[model samples]
Target: MSSSMASSLPPLPRRVGWVGTGVMGLSMATHLLSAGHSLTVFNRTASKAAPLLDKGAKLADSPRAVAEQSEVVFVIVGYPSDVRRVALDPDHGVLPGLRPGSILVDMSTSDPSLAEEIAIAAASVSCQAVDAPVSGGDRGAREGKLSIFAGGDRSTVELLSPLFEKLGVLNYMGGPGSGQRAKLGNQIAIASTMVGLVEGMVFAHRSGLDVTRWIKAIASGAAGSKSLELYGERILRRDMAAGFFVHHFVKDLGICLRECQAMGLALPGLALAQQLYLSLIAHGEGNLGTQALILAIERLNNTRLGDGGESSG
Candidate 1:
C-alpha cells in the first residue's frame, strides 16, 4: 500500500457489510474480517457464506438486513440484473436499508449506465455510492492485490481509502460511472488479448514446438502480458478450474460490445472474442475457466494442446 492511498478518516474495525460470497467475494470479505472489522455478510446461497460465518462474520437474511447493520456496504454479485436486484430492489435491496450518509460500494463488473443509476438512487436517499469494479481475478482477490477502479464522489472515495487499501491499489477514475467505463475498457483489452493468447498457444502446439518452453521463452519478451503470465501454466496443465468463469467473461464482453456500439464504434476483435466465448457457453463449458478458450481454438484446428489429438469439443 502506498502512503498516499491511506485514509485518515474512517477508523479501524468499522462496521462493514459484504454482499456476495462467491469465489472472489469470499476472499475479499475475508480480508476485511481478518483486518478486524465488524463484518456482516449476505449471499443468496447461505451455504456458500459458511466460511465467513465460521470465521466470526455475521450472516444477514437479505441485502437490506446487511445494510442496516453496516456503516459501509460492498456488493459484488454476478450480472447487472443481480446488481439491480440487490442494490435497488425496493423490497429487499441495500439502498432501502442504508442509513443517511452511509456508503454503498458496488465492485461488480456491470453496465456503466447502471452505475450512474445506482449513484443517483443512493443520492436520493442521502447516501453515497461508488462504482469500484476490480481486476486480477481470483488469485488477485485471494492475495488482496486487485486493481480497484473507483468512480463517484472523490471525497467519499477518499474516506473509504482505509478499506480500499486492504483490498488492493485504488485508481480513482472519475465521477459516477467512470469506474465501470474503465472496467469495460479493461474487458475490451482483455478479450482481444485472450484471443491472441490462445491462438498463439494453439499455433505453437501445432508446430511441434514445446509449448510450455515457448511460453517461458517468450513470456519475458514483448509478447508478455498479465493474461499470459496468469493462464499460461494453467493452460499447459489442462486445468480448466474457474479462476474467472467463462460465463462471467462472456457477460463482460457483451457489455463491452454494447458500450462500443452505443459509442458508434466498430470493434471486430472484441466481437470475435465474444463469439468464441459464446461458443464455450453453447458447448456447456460456460462454467469453466476463461483459459478454456484454448479448447475452442483447438477445435477449430483439429488439435489439442498437449496430445496433438483431435479436440473432444
Candidate 2:
C-alpha cells in the first residue's frame, strides 16, 4: 500500500491482548506499545512475558484475563497443539472469557483447518477470529518488517489495518483461514529454497570453489532468496544456533505436506526437504537453525565444515 493511503488508516483499537511472548512475540508487542496502544500480555512462562512488562506492557495472569482485558486478542503460540489449547482448552482457554464483538487474531503458523475451527468456535461466543500468520524471522519481528498474511472479513481487516501496519507489510489472503494456508505455502517455499541452497553449496564445494564467496556473489541474483542469503553465512561458518528451530521447520513442512496430500498434489522437493529435516531431528539437531540442513548436505557429500565435530547434524 502507498504511504499516503496508509496515513489515512483508521486509528488502531486501543486495547490489545498479546499472548505468546517468545522471540517474535516480544518485538511485536513492543511495537504496539510504541505505537501507543494499551497491551495486556500473557505467556505460559512468566519470564518470557517479562520484557514486555518492563516496556510498560501490562501482564495478564492468564489467557482468559488477556481475552477479558482487551478489544483484540492476538495469539502467537508455538505449535498446532498449543494453538488449540490456547483457543479451545476449557478453563485456561481464552474462549470462555472473551466477550462478544471482540476479535482474536492468531499470528501463529498452524493448521488452516484448525484455525477455521477456531473461527467457528469464537463466533459461537459472538466474537470474530482470524488466522493472520506471519513471516520474516526474529530479525524481521525486531525490525517491524515482517510480512503478515491475514484471513478475515474485509471490513474487519480494514479495522485492524493500523495494527497490522505496526507489525509489518500486510496481505489480505481471504476469509477465515486463508492466512494459515498461505503460511503453509510460505513454509513450502522456504523448505524447498533451503534444499536448493544445500544442493548448490554442496556442488560448489565439490567443484573446489570458495563456497562462502560463491554463495555471497550468487545470492543477490534471481536464484537466491531470504533463506539463501540469511542462511548462507550460517552454512559457511557452521553456526547452528536456533534462529528458528529445525524441529519447527520440520513441523511446518509436515503441515504443508499434509495439505498437499489432501489437495491430491505431489511435490517431490517438499518430500525430500521434509525427509532431510526429519533426518536432522534424528541426528539430534532439532534445536539448530533451519540452515542446519547444510550439515545434512555435507554428510551426503562426505565433507565437514571445520571443527564443528560430532554428528549433531
Candidate 3:
C-alpha cells in the first residue's frame, strides 16, 4: 500500500525465528538481527547457520524449536517439498510449536497451492501465515534492497511492514498464495530476459565484437535489464558461482509451467528457457548460477564466448 499506511502499523515482534540459512537466507536473517531483534535460527547444516550464530542469533535444533522461541517465524528454504516439511511436518514442523497469534511467514519460491495449504494449517492452530516470496538476487539480499511480494490478510501483511521494511520494499499482493503467483510471474519474465541476454552475448562473441564493450553500450539503452546489469560481468568473467542456483531456477520455472498449464496459457519463451536450464542440470552444472545459461547456449551453437573456441559439450 502507501508508505504512510505502513508507517502507521505496529512494529513486528522482537523475537524472530528463521529457517534456511543458505546463500540468500543468511543475508536476509542477518538484517532482522541487525535491527535488534532476538533471533533463533535452524538449518539442515548447522555450519551454514554459523555466521548468524556468530552474530548473536541462537541456533535452534529444529524448525519446531525455532518457532517455540519466536513470535514471528520465517521459512525460506530450497524446494516446495522442503517448505512442506519444515512448516507442516506434523512432528517437527513450525506449525506444531506455534502459539496462537504467532505469525508464520514463508519467503520461499514455492507452489501457490502450498501457500494456501500453509495458511489454512496455521489457521487451524490459531496462528497466522503469510506468503512473502522475494526477488533481487544475492547482492540485493545483502544490500537489503529486495522487492518483497507479500500475500495474506491485508491487515496482517500490513502489520508486518515494519519488519519487512528492514529487508526491502513490501507489496501486499492479496490473499494467501498471491505472493507466490506474483513470484512465478517474476520468474517467467526473468527466464525470457536471461535467454535474450545470453543469446545477445553469444552473438556478440561470434561477430568479433568486444563483448564487454557491447554490454556497456546496450546496458543503459532500451535493451538494458536488471538481469543484464546483475549477471553480465559474471558471465564475462566465467564466474558461475551460485548467486541463484541453476537447479532452484529450474524448480521455479517448473512451477510456472504447471501454473500456466492450469490457466490454459502458452508461454513458449518460458518453455524454451526451462529446457535450456534443464540441460545444465543434466550436464552437472545445476549448482552454478543462472548466468550459466550462457553455457547451454554456447553448447547449442558450438561456440564458446570470449575464447573463440568451440564448446566441449
lDDT of 1 at 134: 98
TM-score head-to-head 2 vs 3, winner = 3
| Candidate 2 lDDT tens digits, 146-260 | 9999996666777788899999999999988899999989888888888888888777776666776677788778987898767777777777787788898888888898899
Summing lDDT over every window of 10 consecutive residues in candidate 3, give the lowest-scoring window.
1-10
The superposed Cα distance between candidate 3 and the true structure at residue 278, in angstroms, equals 0.2
What TM-score quantifies how close candidate 3 is to the native fold? 0.95
Per-residue lDDT tens digits for candidate 1, residues 3-121, read: 13223335542999999999899999999999999999999999999999999999999999999999899999999999999999999999999887788999999999999999899
Candidate 1 residue pairs that clash:
none
* Clashing residue pairs in candidate 2 (N, C-alpha, C atoms within 3 angstroms): none
- Candidate 1 off by > 4 Å: 1-13, 307-313
Q: Which stretches of model 2 miss by more than 4 angstroms?
A: 1-11, 307-313
Full-model lDDT for every candidate: 0.90, 0.84, 0.91
Which candidate model has the greater lDDT, 2 or 3? 3
Write one digit per residue (lDDT tens) for candidate 3, span 1-313.
2234333433668889999999999999999999999999999999999999899999999999999998889999999999999999999999999877788999999999999999999988877889999999998899999999999878788778888998899998999999999999999999999999999999888887888888899998999999999999888888899889999999999999999999999999999999999999999999999999999998999888763322222
For all predictions, the C-alpha RMSD in Å is 3.8, 4.6, 3.6
